[model samples]
Target: MSVVITQVFNGFSLGSILLFVAIGLAVTFGLMGVINMAHGELIMVGAYMTYVVQQIFAKYAPQSMGYYFFIAIPVAFFVSALLGWGLEKILIRHLYHRPLDSLLATWGVSLILQQIARTIFGAPNVAVLPPEWLDGGVRIAGVVFPYKRLFILVFVILSIFALYIYLTKTPAGRRIRAVTLNRDMASCLGISTRKVDAYAFAIGSGFAGLAGCALTLLGPIGPTIGTYYIVDAFMVVILGGVGKLIGTVLGAFGIGLVSTLMEYSTSATMAKVMMFALIIAFLQWKPSGLVSVKTRSLD
Candidate 1:
């Protein structure tokens, strides 16, 4: 029973990581209908930013090293979001409605980002030491839960809550939703659809970046770190239903827990293969996804 509980907790922690990474991608894809191939690179960028900040503090402000991770979170978000904003203004904005072009362009951007990272940071993996606060675990009923994972779970929850508040209560969020539901109608109602696109893209990019920063607590950082998880993010989003936060939350945990349980009985590789097969079968029965956004159908 203790082992089962531990495994379940681990699954939730893993799901939290996926939730962080997928939220941005889900929102951007759902709202803009753009397959941003460069999103994983943005996650890499965020992890690198966290690495850079840690190094900066270690060299110049050693006394504050313990708290630098907190500061790095916002910094990573801003940097990644700024890059996303610029990409939209310069590249993505023009490719609206041209899904193929957007895919090609962003895939190229991802490669460029990977190369840039290699040139600047070298090709080897880098490690960021977790702060003292994240070094321990809490024990309950003979099961020990790591602090780092707990922090990530709480962060994911807070992020979801904040996003829910923004989307349901705020004017800017309403504009985003309007555009998500119907770009033409939103524009007709005086909402600047283009501006909303930019905002949504940036927010999504920022969330991925934030996820990357949190990830440094789990393992080493590398140029292609984000690429490693992009597929999983896509799977979570596709299964969760585009543009639905509740679906995303439930889907992530469901997949996370199920995958973890499967791993207990089979090889990791087989577990993923089985998971994909299940998803394929599930989608065959319901092509729309677990929960779809209600919008006006185009005739």
Candidate 2:
């Protein structure tokens, strides 16, 4: 029973990371119709930023390990956001309606980012030690839950809530949603669709950065680390439905729980296979995804 509870927490933690990565993809895809293959590279950039911060802290502030993560969080956000914004201004802006071309271009970008990371950071994986406060496990109803996992779950939930409020209650967010629904109409209403796209990409990429930071709490950082989460992130976004924040959350939890249960019953590889099969089945049942977005034609 304790093991089950522990695994459940692990699932939630993993799901939360996936949620962070997928939410950004969901927004970009639903709003701009750009299949950003470089999304995972943004996550890699965040992880590298965390590693850099760790190095800086080790050199100048050896006693400040606890505060390093806190400092790196915002740095990661800014770094990833800047990269995403630049990409939007450069490559993605031109491929707005040509999804296939965008996919190819972004995939090329992903390769470039990965190679650059390798050249700078080397191919070796770097360890990211968690703070003392988050390194241990907490006992709950005879179950031991790792503090790192618990923190991730809580952080992800809060992030999603913040995003929800921003999207629903804020004027800027409303304009973003409007643009997602109909770009031409939103533009006609004096909304700067290009600016909205940039903002949305920045926010989404920033979340990926946060996910990279969170991942360091679990294990080592590597140049290709983002590849591990990319497929899972896409799964969550697709399962949840494009452009629906709530759907992303639901899909994350659902996939997380199922995958966790499978991991207990079989090997991790087998578990992944089972999970993918299930996702395929789920998609067949709802070809448009779990949540359907109502798109309006300007014409």
Q: Which candidate has the top score in TM-score? A: 1
Clashing pairs in 2: none
Model 1 error, position 289 (Å): 1.6
What's the TM-score of every candidate structure? 0.96, 0.95
Residues 130-248, model 1: lDDT tens digits: 88888889999999998999999999889878888888999999999889878999999999988999998998898888888988989998999888988888888888887788878
Model 1 ranges off by over 4 Å = 294-299
Model 2: residue 219 alpha-carbon error in angstroms: 0.6
Candidate 2 wrong stretches, greater than 4 Å: 294-299
Clashing pairs in model 1? none
Question: Positional deviation of 233 in candidate 1, in angstroms?
Answer: 0.9
Q: Give the Å shift of residue 164 in candidate 1.
A: 1.6
Question: Candidate 1: how large is its RMSD?
Answer: 1.7
| Model 1 global lDDT (CA atoms, 0 to 1) | 0.88
Q: CA lDDT of each candidate?
A: 0.88, 0.85
